[model samples]
Target: MSSAVATVPGAEHAGVSLLRGDGVITSYTPSSSTVSEVDRLQSTYREGPCVTALWDQHTVVVDDLVAEADRWPRFAPEAAARGILSMLSFQLFTRDDSLGALNLYSSVRKRFDLDSQMLGGLFASQAALVLAGAQESVRLHRALATRDVIGQAKGILIERFGVDAETAFTMLVHSSQNTNLKLVDVARWLVQGRDRPVSS
Candidate 1:
């Protein structure tokens, strides 16, 4: 974590935290107590930037807590509880799609400098690499599911169109290409009659 902050280059009095996959308060710099408290609140209430970051796998910022509206009502109270006036948080994401976050806070209202925010973002990037390992495990587990679904859809195509697996896959690919959609979308539609494949 110190190494990550050190590599950040421009942050002053930087505070960083690494969230657990479950959005728990895993660890952070001691000066980042508000962030730690917010993490605890998020874990306890299932709300705030930590939980939001995990869910959305993106950055979250509260520039000015006092002037800000009800963007995060529950988190607002939690911020008040922790004496936090401003914060910036980002999800530490893996390529395979699991999430965690790095949170930073300041006692002064809207006190964050742009460099600190970027530093926080950099922190998230490092944690994202760690998450990639977990995410790959998840991806491996889902490979079978993906293959099964595609395979089922391919079988449906073969039966319906009297084509071989290669031809069926080709047709699926052709349709996807023609309509600017993914092969999975075409396969999903083929498997389920009268259905449109919707992205999750």
Candidate 2:
């Protein structure tokens, strides 16, 4: 089913980026350092297909770069300066979770249309499968970090409340559950005032 969805040739020219837990695009499939530079420039300016894909959670097409000055003046100039003249981007997302964007860049205007958009959507769906796997990886990493934070918070709670480690963790978990928040969030809040520095 996913293969049928990804029949388009995005993997040939497209650059697929997977977002890290810190909300930065940590990796891309095409392995082009140029794409990351382009993405960084677009993100810095807050325009172009990259930002549009992340914001709208859908495909973004710049069918004409030289012709479309009124649309994105800031972005087009930078793209033109970098010898990029056209761009198409698709977000990898499910109903609630956004993974990242698959970006396609060209050196000419009017290189894509509605047909390309349909094809790009198909490519994005396929990209979402890989992104879902990346999400599982992120979940595992986050779980480990949360466990560490909980351990530190537990030490504080045990000392403050005169409770055992189990009781302290149960308290933190219960509070998180009751507040509809992640355990990491609760632990962070509890440890925010601590002298210990955070990695991020």
Candidate 3:
């Protein structure tokens, strides 16, 4: 965001909008509190340059928010009142899904030009790639941790019940189903219990 504010012409503030796992769009890495408030307005109104860029178009450029009030009836007036006159947004995406948008805000009318768009687009693309890689790494790490805990649970079950690996796994599945809990939860419970010291 700091890089964007420094490099993008007329950009006073910058922010990343991301689609959360729960299907909500949220502001991330906002350059200032003003950017965060503007993003909140976008979420509340659901009609802004960032929303349009994320869902309908690859990019959105608003030269004058006051003049464009009709386009985004609820959001424009509110944003303009906050002293944000011009805005630029570029859709951020990966090969598999639409990630979110990169947004630039300016207090001057007609602040962003074609040059700004070009430079911001390049930055947005790089941001998308970095975000995608970070998300994938988190997923891989979570999967590995889950596997390790489940393996430990299986080992405990096999030793205590004098059963084979397959039987131990089946027992875990049955416990999960009977308790209406996630398989991982059941495995975690068993593993945690095994580590607790017995009462005298």
Measured by TM-score, the strongest candidate is: 3
Model 1 Cα RMSD, 1 decimal: 10.0
What TM-score would you give candidate 2 relative to the actual structure? 0.62
TM-score of each: 0.49, 0.62, 0.88
Off by over 4 Å in 3: 94-98, 194-200
lDDT of 2 at 193: 68
Better of 2 and 3 by TM-score: 3
Which scores better on lDDT, 2 or 3? 3
lDDT of 2 by residue, 1-200 (tens): 22422454332245765544455554365545666677766656766777778776587777666665676778777777776777888877633544577787766666666776787787677778877787779879988987888888888788887889888888888878877878778788888765532221
Q: Any residue pairs clashing in model 3, and if so which?
A: none
Candidate 1: segments with Cα more than 4 A from true spot? 1-33, 94-98, 130-200
- In candidate 2, list every pair of residues with a backbone clash: none
Write the residue-wise lDDT of candidate 3 on 74-142 in tens digits. 999999999999999999873343358999999999999999999999999998888778878988999
Query: Which candidate order results from sorting by lDDT in descending order?
Result: 3, 2, 1
Model 3 TM-score (2 dp): 0.88
Please tell me which predicted candidate would have the highest lDDT against the true structure.
3
